[model samples]
Target chain A: MILTDLRGRYQFGFGRFMERDYDDIPGTYPLDSRTYRKGYHVNMFLMSLNDAECRDKFAEDEQAYLDTFRMTEDQKSAVLDRRFLDLLKLGANVYYAFKLISFDRQPPQVMYGQMAEPRLTFDEFQQMMIDGGRPIDGNRSVEEWKDG
Target chain B: MAKLIAGMGTSHVPGLGAAMDNGKTQEPYWKQLFEGLEPLRAWHRANTPDVNIIVYNDHATEFSLDSYSTFTVGVGENFEPADEGWGPRQVPSMSGYPDLAWHIVESAMAEEFDLAVHASMDLDHGFTVPLSIAYGQPKEWPAAVVPVCVNVIQHPLPTALRCYKLGQAIGRAVASFPEQINVGIWGTGGLSHQLGGERVGVVNPEFDQKFLDNLSRDPLANTRISHTEFMREAGCEGVEMIMWNVMRGALEDDVDEVFRLYHIPVSATAYGAIILENK
Candidate 1:
């Protein structure tokens, strides 16, 4: 079934983490109508990273630069801290969010590797791709939980 | 009569364009990617196509959530390379063919595919990186272009089957055009890798290679793939494979694989490319 089909309503009861743990789901984001609205200012600042002059201004004084946009403190701090993973949580699409990574003059592989829970070393992550890929089984969630 | 001569697919990862710009091809990280492009560069030089039908998507640079079109046809006269948050590649402005673009638009509408028309569009790295990869940073882009834009970033992206059908309609449109032009359809983006969420840096060479193998004869099998399956088996961004179907379906079902390259860790993705000449 399409993901949209899983929308509408759901009933809940009982255990501690009752809601689905979406953390284990790989390569998905809320880059749709809702997230777009939330992250517009953050994304706008990111888009400005295309300009060399803008990047210079941004790196010079991070707070004053980000103040130009209407982003939340979290979004502004993410830009300052280079918290790419946190930025995603606050609704940054990777395509637009990558401008931040570019601003730092770092390859995206570094950020994604750092974001991996259980946090992989850059070498360990690169090795994963070469060894086919991260195994689909068990890796979906920590310990014994499957998506089902 | 206008004819579709060949079709090719390339990853338009911005890192490749940067590598070419900074002369980092000789460096260890980019050496293999530059080496892979050598044959493709020669192929374009030896024989040039009059125009290229570039199938690519914008990365929130030109079209934001303000107005998103699922399928856009550029019927403009010229396209400027956009500064996609990290400066534009120093490539020449791309030439566009309005006559051919409009004809395809009309034909696609006639075939029940309502393609949005773009009078002005800025070509992002998704559109220009492939140009830099194959043509080098020439004074002017040798081949004229017809840009076919798709919406891939947002969820509920257009499916592979729809893209393939659009390519077939485009093929019929090209054949009916009243000009003696040799055209190439280029699909750009994503061999396999996830850029967002927990699965970032996940690259699958197996899925990438098999796709290269099966694209010539068994394309519909690739098109029949579900979105979640691609997310699971290939990764989220790997769903960009639908763009290749648009290129493949434009050619005849039988295509000869001319040149192929598959390399890993180009920035963060598995970059795969292949040149297929229609038989």
Candidate 2:
């Protein structure tokens, strides 16, 4: 009786604001909803690493393996070249990209190093993190932090 | 009838897991943030609930880009931690409340909220790290968990309003359960820190504080926030704040801010934690 008498109520402050579009940041590939839709094939193909059989097949014949999935020529090239940024631009999420990195037996810092301007070696990237993460002030956005 | 007793939110920064796993709580870098979790420790010490409906996003550890479900409830018997390249954390398996999970799914679906069902899936730090923070490295989780996985990693996350409404539906579902049980809702992730791009360590304490104030004072107003604003003002990945709405929406309109924590530089993230009890 007490439960029924006391009903739950949620306050939703109904209002309006100019909903903004997510398309400003330069040199950054946002894994936003649209990107997910556009890069669906490429991302799913990478996701297949969860299965040992697929991983074995990819190890044997990279192109023949990629052919099984209908990815774009650009995505095919990005994966072929082990281009982390290229894959990111083509719609691969960092976490899913980890599978690809692990397949290459490389640490994730390799991908991090790949993203930075004037790309550093895997060792340089690891040392930088140890020294202190890439300072946020100068690397915020291409528009805000022009020097980066 | 089942009753909703508490709602809380926190970040699932994998580094926090590393800290706890490696026992670096007293280090200068981690000392303050580790101290922030004392309130949760105290709360659990006393008023521990029987079950926690953990609402967290999967970080590509399990559900990869292939089959990402917007909202999924784990109705399996137990959830074991994942290997995730590095070996699994030394923690006991988490017990799942299948009866409650299935009930919530049915109730949520009946209310017109499409929720996916999962019998088995490896949970990553997003789910496990918060467990470590709240329950410590206990032999077992202090309470049974009904894992509710939300897809925040993929772009085009559910609108803040939709997350709030989904929480409301989950609250109703929990309340309508025939079995009587004390349930706590936990939403984990995000307090304004971006991991990717040039903006690697953007810790917006100002934005983080306002988020805490509003989440504590008036979450209703929070639902009106747009995803673009969260990404821009908060950070590219800061939009993960939507998961908190699910936690807040599960509570009664009246709640008390029992405890809250906010710290920065938790490995490229501004970690945040909060506890809200039905007042």
- For lDDT, the strongest prediction is 1
Q: Which lDDT tens digits does candidate 1 get at residues B1-279?
A: 998999999998887888888888899777777887899989988768999999998987787756788999999999999877667668898889999999999988998998899988899999999898889878998999999998888765788889888889999999999999999999989888777776676666777788888787788887887666666566678788889989988999888999998887676678889999988
Candidate 2: which pairs clash? A32-B155, A33-B155, A33-B156
Per-model C-alpha RMSD: 5.1, 10.0
- Per-residue CA lDDT of model 2 for A40-131, tens digit only, reads 88878777765567788999999999998889999998999989877887877766776787677675667767765557676765565545
TM-score of 1: 0.87
Per-prediction interface RMSD in Å: 3.1, 3.4
Compose the digit string of candidate 2's lDDT tens values, residues B107-199: 899888899999888887889988998888887788999999988877657889999999999999888898888999999999786655544
Off by over 4 Å in 2: A1-20, A32-34, A49-82, A100-110, A117-148
Task: Report, for every candidate in turn, its global Cα lDDT versus the true structure.
Answer: 0.81, 0.79
After aligning candidate 1 to the native by TM-score, how far in Å is the CA of A16 from where it should be? 20
